[model samples]
Target: MAATVEAVIAALRVTLEEAQKSREASWKVEAVNRWIGQLPGSWSGRWRRLVLKSDASGNARRDELVAHVRAVIAFLETNRQQIAQSRKWWPLRRRWPANSPIANAPVAAPASSSARPVNLLRVRKPMPGIH
Candidate 1:
């Protein structure tokens, strides 16, 4: 009877250890899921690549996952100002059509009398057949 009790206790200890490991793994997966979900749209592709690399690494430590999230957050924060400025100016700096009047015209004088006139003519390229 004592031997049976000892065996049962040993089995219970193994079961508890396995349960704890399962719980920890579940928590880590949930944390990674939350981090991925919260990642910015612009950063999703990078995050996906990180996840693939991490999976290939086979070292799914919680700290490593958190480190990746923090790194991405830091990168986005550091570049946020530049990214915003570029987005703000991108549309305004669009390429002008070659045939537009503004493209063909010389610079006009500003309306204010004190403003100096500027020359800004487009240089024409010689035709291939005529050259």
Candidate 2:
């Protein structure tokens, strides 16, 4: 019975590791998808069909995950080069200026009462005639 319990624990550990890897892979795929979607019109669709088609299988094997990530990186690099070469693609790189009012707005401070500073070292005076 002890051997069986140990074996079960080991199996659960393996299962947990696999689940974590699967989740990490899924997150990577989603991130790549988001970047691809940000590309100019029809480019995202074309790239998705060409580069990320294999990811539709829903398999999270490590090799498959690496392949998907590599494909996405390659696609992004190529697209970036193309965008740099084309004058019409400048809009893709244009971001709102950092100095904008919304971006410069100060964060709100935490709410607190406006109280006088406490003096921890102050001695209390003895009450008159109370001795």
**lDDT score at residue 103, model 1, on the 0-100 scale:** 85
Model 2 TM:
0.32
Off by over 4 Å in 1: 1-52, 56-59, 88-131
Backbone atom clashes (below 3 Å) for every candidate: 0, 0
Tell me the tens digit of each residue's lDDT in model 1 across 10-107.
44344334434553442234433433334333235433442313354344554454455455445545655554444321245646888888788889
Q: What is the lDDT of candidate 2?
A: 0.48
Q: All candidates: CA RMSD in angstroms? A: 20.0, 18.8
| Alpha-carbon shift of residue 82 in model 1 (angstroms) | 0.8
Please, what are the lDDT tens digits per residue for candidate 2 over residues 1-131?
23332333344344435545664544334433443444443254434363233346544455565565555445444555454454442355536668888778899997897997778779577899997
In candidate 1 the C-alpha lDDT for residue 129 amounts to 96
**Residue pairs with backbone overlap in model 2:** none
lDDT of 1: 0.45
lDDT of each: 0.45, 0.48
Model 1 alpha-carbon miss at residue 131, Å: 56
